[model samples]
Target chain A: MNAPQRIVVDPVTRIEGHLRIEAETDASGKITRASSAGTMVRGIEIILRGRDPRDAWAFAQRICGVCTLVHGMASIRSVEDALHRAIPSYSIPRNAEIIRNLMIGAQYVHDHVMHFYHLHALDWVDVVSALKADPKATSSLAQSISNYSKSSPGYFADVQKKVKTFVEQGQLGIFANAYWGHPAYKLPPEANLMAVAHYLEALAWQRDVVKLHAIFGGKNPHPNFVVGGTPSAISVHSSSGAAKARGGQDGTAVNMVGLQTVQTVIKQMKDFVDQVYIPDLLAIASFYKDWGAIGSSGGNYLSFGDMPEKDIWTPDSFLIPRGVILDGDISKVHPINMDDDNEIQEFVSHAWYKYKDGDDKGLHPWKGETEFNYTGPKPPYEQLDVDQKYSWLKSPRWKGKPMEVGPLARALIMYATGNKQMKELVDYTLKTLDVPVAALFSTLGRTAARGLESKVIADAMQGMFDSLIANIKAGDVKTFNEQYWDPASWPKSMKGVGLMEAPRGGLSHWMVIEDGRIDNYQAIVPSTWNAGPRDTAGNSGPYEASLQHNHVLHDPKQPLEILRTIHSYDPCLACAVHVTDPEGEELIQVKVK
Target chain B: MSLEDIRVVVDAGESSPYQADALSGNAPVLLRELAEHVRQLMAAGEPTAIDLNALPLTPADLDWLKATLGEGEISVTLHSDGESTLAETACPGVWWVTHHNESGHVVSRFIEVAFVPELVKAHPEDVKTGLEYLESLIFDLS
Candidate 1:
């Protein structure tokens, strides 16, 4: 038997942001204890302490670079929800809702595809082994899987030449420092080659799909957003028509050409998801089927559903249903109340934060404080004192229980809600993979759920586009609502929570507005729910729990199994660590000689 | 949501509406990186490349970089898998490379600190394949 060993993978590669994972293994090489730490601290909430609620979206959207528009959307919804509290009839135009839906749906398709290929695929596919594969055999394998036309022998040969050139050059730019040829990588050489080809294809595929956001919001990353509705308005006349004389309203406004571009992007998104993304996902997943029994996080899920078709506040018209499933029971789903402080609360016992009164008690987001108290080791040191303060993320729980939130949670919630489309897609995937229902609770299940929901969202984009077109033809060109737009509409004090299903998971922004200015703002993002540390009751987060359950590291030095589970959540730490005490002094000072 | 209430914070000589502070650009960090890579290449005979597309550079930062690192003598363009351009910066051993897809959209951009950009070089296997093709052509002639 081996002695107990400890391993740390600091600054996990191929992730959206900075993270550090420390795990201890027993004599059998099975993980015994684990701790997830978000090393960076971002205090965007503190920045919005006194700004106008209407302008919060601009500053809030900078929280993340990958999930660019989600924070902005949530901020806008927060302001609108605050105003709607004073005036009941306040809502954005129906076309605005549809346009937002189209943008969010495009985000899901684009972000998920990029995650699968660029971020998570290296965990399973061995790039060095791909060099040993024959191009013709790789082509045959790709053709057998899906009818993607780019899978020709000549095309694969060209890709192979480029990869060979890159490898020979001895500078593997992005592919450097990876655990290549690790024993845990299970895919065959041909599958690796085919996946490598699609990896490059997805890089190009993402470039065009984001044009949908540019068309609607006027940019891609951190696109222009507004409080009342979407940024752009509809122009009934075509860009080349008489409207051209009034100031060249081509891409600036939603005209015929813009609508046509949107439709084309929709087609491109759906086609790629159907032909390329899903096939590659299923193919790669089939090779690692044993992962079905690994990395389950206690089977507790939560989702604040998004994509409203009619009213912004109503959940009946939402495409994704919201609910909670506990203890792996699909029969009973507990409803969530955002206003109920007792339901959803965050604890900082195992975190580096302290409440004004007590660090042990859980506070809801509306009352959540951001006071940092670092008691761990100083910089350039080994091993955090895990029993004391460890991570920068607060432990968020529902009714004193840590819950998993992300694609897997959303899928389970939708399936438990008896959603017809989701049910059909889930059933088809289960049958195709020959995995039991319990498989949906594991690491591979989380990855497959992302692809499965990407398909659903990509297909749903067409319906959203059709609805937008029909509404335009019906002479409804309104995109904003001005009923409560004026700050003088007089609500001395108001509080609101903007909830949405971001690409990663359930994201909610809580705001307390006073005199048209933001008093307090707190965002409990998806990664905070998924990658948070232990709570006062000694409960582990999804990231820690998943790593501790049935996880065996073949080589402790190269923790590829840890990367597989962590990357499966698509952890974004820049959006997770928002605690800052602000001591009214500079934390660092530089001196010049 | 109203356009009138949205104030333009920085009004300058820029044509586009989006304005950013020139002082807060990525040019300085990138310059330091280029200097480090050049030093490494000289001392250890090691080559390094930085993917510019991966960096968060505003247009102002790019313009500043282009003006600072002027062009050198040699410029080459390869027309394979779309059009790619590799041009040497005024600081020798530093090259600017850009890869465009078939639609002419820039897929990737990089700065390579090396003697010659690797993409411009012909791999040995490709040269061997070329030799085989030329031999087959001679056989056809016979």
Candidate 2:
């Protein structure tokens, strides 16, 4: 019998941050085992020590450019949670709550659209093949799928020309390094062209849609998030006359123009998702239906829950309820307690870092430590020493078990807990593809769930906006509560966890405040939960576990199948480790020694 | 004063006639230039690149530009030796391209009016070597 061979994909592209995957496969090309490693040490937690808790959001938001606002939201929520603990009488206003929901909802929609088209679509799409498609046929095919306004033959012809020019010029720019014409690619030429066209559409669509965040939170990337409430003030009266007198600078308020722009952006989001994103996903999923069996991570799912109804502290008020589903059993959901020391813990046994107590012992985020321990081989070496410390990411465990997080977990939990909308969406998608409920547990299912949830969140944004407008009509225009902004009002010693369902998955920022300054701050981000290394119990993380089973590699050099599985998780190594080397070199150094 | 009179005063403050007209004026002249560039690309298939850094753009002007041009079909981030991003505007042929240094700072920004940005194209030299490498691999495997 032939020995198993190893295939390594260093610096996995299209995702938010740096990641490397090493898989050992039999001669038959089926993966037997896999190791997921976050190659960079993010020492943001270490740098955060002794800083004012109020300013932590600004620093923490810089963790990842892709998931910019989520970290800021989590950071501010952590400070607010601590403040609320200090002042039990403190509460965020309804207006503030509504605005935060809009911001979060916008992030989910924007991130999901960007992820599907810009990042993950190429894994399925063949850009070179799109050039071969008949523009008229592509237009007809696009129109047959949805009522998207951009489905003119002339429009498609222009897009085809643009793509053709790129191909003829022998420059595939972003389309470079693609596994074009690979056996795994199954989309018809016309379908590929339609997807390619929408892929271009989504890029433009996202820029406009994200302006909602800028209107409400100041800027798109790493928007301003105040601890008590949003930074935006609702302007009931026009500052136009005043602005003109002081030179045409727009006022810092949610005026009629701002409100209308938000409305326009929301409509645009709905139109694009309904017309372009969802249809493109379904169309693409139809082609890659076989991927439904590829990447299943034991069906254990976890969600910290996000988008609160009344207060963030109250778990029952969450839009996506917090719970745990173990072993793919949807009938029963175990309640998640973020405060319990036994509920959530990070293990560094398989990771490079060492804990204060022991390398094998798991520590809760409240007592989490970020100690850099590079015990692996030096740079420019080959395969990782997987038997020892491999990744920079600490293995995070819920109840001593590795669980998958993100859209799949959220969708499964929502479906199991009898969320009507989620059930309808999942049922419709599965029925359309003629796949079973079990199919929702694989890589394609994970990607599909992301698309489905974007629609759910985008539709929900209207309700949130309406509620905000209703509040304004009732003369409740206040956006910030200044009661807890002062440091003197905070408790001398306090620790609190700010939990939210970021676009990727469940994210939490745990902070210990001493004299109103952060003593020890640790952020257990979503990507860490999904992409961390194996735990003390030797349980592989979601990324590693998902790559197991029948993920067969046709070509070891291309490794397109591996990319499909990893990109489905939308790995964001930037959120896990906040530090990059001075040279900003490749995170994964693949050596074949 | 009557309650109706008080309501009227408040309404007057909130709604300004000049403000409504001035909002339209906020649109930048670059939008016209960008449109012309797109027309050029469509007619002649000749790529036109505009350096946005050279243009005097205020924050308001930038916002207007974003709104006016809108985002088009594709946005790409290329990480070779350094990071560069190219995004197409709603105008099919117009594109926004930015080059970043190693530290993730934008060194130069351009609005390239073409079917696709030049930076996204594969270098001819690299393609030549890539083809050779592929042929060699095929030969070795066979």
- TM, every model: 0.81, 0.80
When summed lDDT is taken over every stretch of 10 residues in candidate 2 chain B, the lowest stretch is B1-10
Residue pairs whose backbone atoms clash in candidate 1: none
Measured with C-alpha atoms, the lDDT of residue A314 in candidate 1 is 90
C-alpha lDDT values of all predictions:
0.85, 0.82
Best candidate (score: lDDT): 1
In candidate 2, position B112 carries an lDDT of 88
What is the per-candidate TM-score for chain B? 0.80, 0.74
Runs with alpha carbons beyond 4 Å of true place in candidate 1: A238-240, A243-251, A580-593, B1-142
DockQ of 1: 0.02
Position A117, candidate 1: lDDT: 95
Cα RMSDs, all models: 11.7, 13.1
